[model samples]
Target: MEKREWKVCVTGGGSFIGSYLVNKLLQKGYIVHATLRSLKDAKTGILRGFPEAKEKLVLFEADLYSPHQFEAAIQGCDFVFHVATPLNHEPGSSQYKNTVEAALAGSKTIFMSCLRSGTVKRLIYTASVLSSSPLKEDGTAFKDFVDETCWTPLNDSLSYVYHDDHHKDYTYSKTLTEKEMLSYNNNENGCGGLEVVTIPCGLIGGDTIQSFASGSIAVCLSLITGNSETYKSLKFLESLLGKVPLVHIDDVCEAHIFCMENSSMKGRFLCASSYVSIAEIAGYYIQHYPEFNVKQEYVEGKKVDVKWGSTKLCEKGFVYKYDTKKILDDTIECARRIGYL
Candidate 1:
């Protein structure tokens, strides 16, 4: 089938990775059905500005909590990209529970929709590195490297023990969602012959077409904009997490497209470039943009070793287009252009 004749659905098409993926799809002449939580979201305006968006892109309103809402958006699509997952950073608010519920329900809803669609041949799920096995479990760090075979240990007891840590909750949600998705796929009657491929990505950073920065990019922007409160919160969290594996936004978008086109691609693929600590990122900003008054402080703590392997992705003939340095540079440039710097 011609690329223009192929209809694909992208959930959370206005998000950091989603926006980039939507633009790429439009450029390739694919008919894209993109979903947004609301028409009022600023991201809707940003996505509408993409090239050929008016001609090839269709916007639909869908809610993560409401699975039935996705039916209209995903029906009659050739491929489904389930990229929208909720991230709750607010520990004090009840948003964490809502976020977790949304992630799980939303995934199941999308998967079931794909099964019902009949036209969807493949479903590309954008998972997180957190969904994979932990670098540290039960207060003891694992000595081995994390690969596709590793699954994050879901300990309800441990989850309650670390209830104060919001990251743990988020991680649990992703792990459960991924596990359920895979389990559903394995059930011949459940997936209806629809192929599911999960891409567990690391700390996604780099230029985004969205009006606002989110995820790791938001953390970077906090430092760039000299937001002390935000910086302190992120610094504390990063200190506990250690040097996270970094993945360029563009590289991640490319991985989505590559997975869609490559029929042989199956299972989980790690989409990350390299590892860099939060302190190292601060140091880079301080050195490059001294006027920003970027603070650099080494948090004295046992850094969790993030030695996750991405050799499987590389072996699949996928090459990273951006390194750590390039990622930082591109991010700063984009932030400046967008007046966030």
Candidate 2:
């Protein structure tokens, strides 16, 4: 049988992770179709990052809330990378609502459309460690290791007091979305014999901070960017110390590509190098860039304690070259490249 040209559609292609995925796919000679709110915005400046691959990057308007908008976006596409989601740490913010709703609605809509279109062969969903395992239940966060087997039961009795409706909603949405996808796997209405891969990654770190300064790694960059006073004053640094697992952006992107090529692989996977403490990362930045380092004393807050395991992905042959040390080194290089170091 002759190999078919992979036509991939990346949702939220204008955003940080999505754009990176688009670039990677385009470079590998795959025809990439990306969704944005508006091509006018993309034309204004979004393609600058991959100036050389501009021709390969096709932008379309496809809102997650609108199913009609997606027909053209996924037409003739063989793969789907659903990377778009609303982000807001503040529990009550509209951003959180939009993120939860969009992810749920948009994801399911795209999957169904792909099934109906009958062209897609595989669907790779970009999920976060947050969905697979959430720490909000214990009033504690994952300051350490987490894996695919872990599930954050927010509605459990343990969080009866603190689990607000919104928190429960977001968690429930993610859980159901993944569960529903699994349920749809072999059904006649679903992917139609298509394969699925869900990657649960931790604090996605990479060489690009300018695009997602408000995202997972941006907090780290903010702390080291002479803005430590705020993080310390709020004792946020304390909560962050020794908490949260870290993963490289490239690895996160690669795992999706790997899963796409490795058709036999199915189900959920947690992609991360290893666990590292915020304090350890802080110490590294302090040593390398004294100008950006702040006193440790100001980082006054309760110590963080959490552990998670990524052995599943590791055992599945997903070797993480960027361990904590390498991640920090690469982060610094990213800073230097962007002139933040």
Candidate 3:
């Protein structure tokens, strides 16, 4: 059968990354089965505007709270992109337990659904680099650089500790979810093993299809908007990796497609286009749009340098197209179009 005739399911199809992935798959002529947590969002209607979407695309409502909810969407699909995550609640909130449970249960449910389908050859998960720590096991010092080989050390404060311990709750949740995603390899469910691949991406920037700007895009825009609270994202990322690691949402979506096409690839692939200082990012923002009066204080030396490398993805012949400037450009343009600016 031709590539265009294959069926692929993308969960969280209305999200920042999922929306782009769904559109790209459609553009490449594949029949896309996309899932959103709810069908009531008026914004998701734009998905149907894509080329040939009326005939080639289908949308389903699936949420992690309900196990087996994704069965209808995953049935007979050749590939599945598990892009939805259950971190919508604040880490310390009362719903935190439900958040964690949903992640584990939802991930297990997706894996089983794919195995039972008997048609899915690959499952690509949307992962985050925040789950990885660049430090040594003892947390005494930084490693040479973070790569696909790096794992968040066991019982590390940021890795496992939660519930009023620290503000790394979201990071910890993602760490657990990613590990659960990889644990399904060679699972003992009788069916042939399902091939799983994950892309642990950096702070994702660039355009989005949603009616509103995504959290990541909003944080980047904070540099000029004077929203100091949003700096927590940078501080958290920098403290963990020793630098700000960034990648365009477009590049991230492309890497997912790259992994799906290269069936032999396995394990986690670290996806980052630039590893730089917050000061550097501030300078670039000022250079491109000085009228915003980018704060110079953010450029002061705030941390040391520890590289987050994408050598694995690059070695797999995946090339990154957007740099820091292009990411900001696309993000700003989209934000303005959506009235977030």
Candidate 4:
């Protein structure tokens, strides 16, 4: 289909990454329909980033579990970016069941609706690094990188302990949800059989383009604002310092656009800038905001062990302009540019 005629719909348009995606699509001159849970919410300053987008961006109140709602949302859309997912982390959180069921059901619903409607030519699903790796094993992430194929396949004994009470449910949901998405063995062009592209992304970092941040921006801000209880203190510091892969939010958006533009790309794409150690991140922070106590102990002048990998995307010509140094530099630069510094 022609770029100008492409009518795109992004689920979770008010969200962090989704907002960016919507804005980018609109900037490229494509008609966009964005989904919100309610018209009231959308009218109440939900889509403030692109006020002009109100004309091109249609707000549809849709529920993930309700197949009918999704069917209505994707009507007449040429591409679907299924980016919405439940993110609650409470241990007894009943939201997990709803979240998982909704994601699985919502994907099927969107894909099926797209195929049946015969409108969408491609569909991109917003997946996560955790979906690929559960982190169920109690090992320090002491490595440098993690790739698309490297998923955390913990046995029954491991899923319970790999994560904490806060995020255990969330991690498990992502792992199972990704698996469920992959399990669909539909042939191309089947009803709901448009190309399914999975983006396994690492920790997203960026400032809020809007007053309200969603997805990785929220997570990064939480870490920055010390709201993330999981990555605080010495133990958390050591654990985090062990290993992680990092990506700037803008790059991730660009990747989504890139994949959409390049129709031949299929299967799993591990979106990351580079493998970064938490200690290295801490060092970067120390260079500027020294007051943030990213507590760590120096034993023999060495840091702890942590590991992640990213090779598949690299092989696919997704060049990372930012390494650890570049990431920190760009982050600080972005902060300065946006006056966060």
Q: What lDDT is obtained when candidate 1 is compared to the true structure? A: 0.76
* lDDT of candidate 3 at residue 338, scale 0 to 100: 92
> Candidates 1 and 2: which is better by lDDT?
1
Q: Candidate 4 residues 1-341, lDDT tens each?
A: 68778888888887778777888888888788888766677432646547567667777787564546867778888788888776642245454354555566667677778777788767777787765542325642423435565566545454333346435555556667666565543564443546777787777775446554334443443335555453433223234334456787777887887777775656778787766555556656666666655444311225534455556666766666556565555555555565554
Top lDDT prediction, candidate number: 3
**Decoy 3 TM-score against native:** 0.91
Weakest 10 consecutive residues, lDDT, candidate 2? Answer: 233-242
Better of 1 and 3 by TM-score: 3
Clashes of 4: 15
All predictions: root-mean-square deviation over Cα? Answer: 3.5, 4.7, 3.0, 4.3
From the highest TM-score down, the ranking of the candidates is 3, 1, 4, 2
Rank all candidate structures by their lDDT, best first, as comma-separated numbers.
3, 1, 2, 4
All models: lDDT?
A: 0.76, 0.64, 0.81, 0.63
Number of the top candidate by TM-score? 3
RMSD of 2: 4.7
Deviation of model 2 at 293, angstroms: 2.4
Backbone clash count, each prediction separately: 0, 8, 0, 15
Better of 2 and 4 by lDDT: 2
TM-score of each: 0.87, 0.79, 0.91, 0.80
Candidate 4's error at 118, in angstroms? Answer: 1.1
Q: lDDT tens string, model 3, 1-341?
A: 67778899999888888888999999898999999888887646878888879999998988777758999999989999999987565345442365666677788889889988999988898888877777777767778788877776646443422123334556666778888887676467644757888888888888887888888888778887777556766666676777877899989989999998884766888888988887888888888888889888888856675766659888889999999888888888888899988
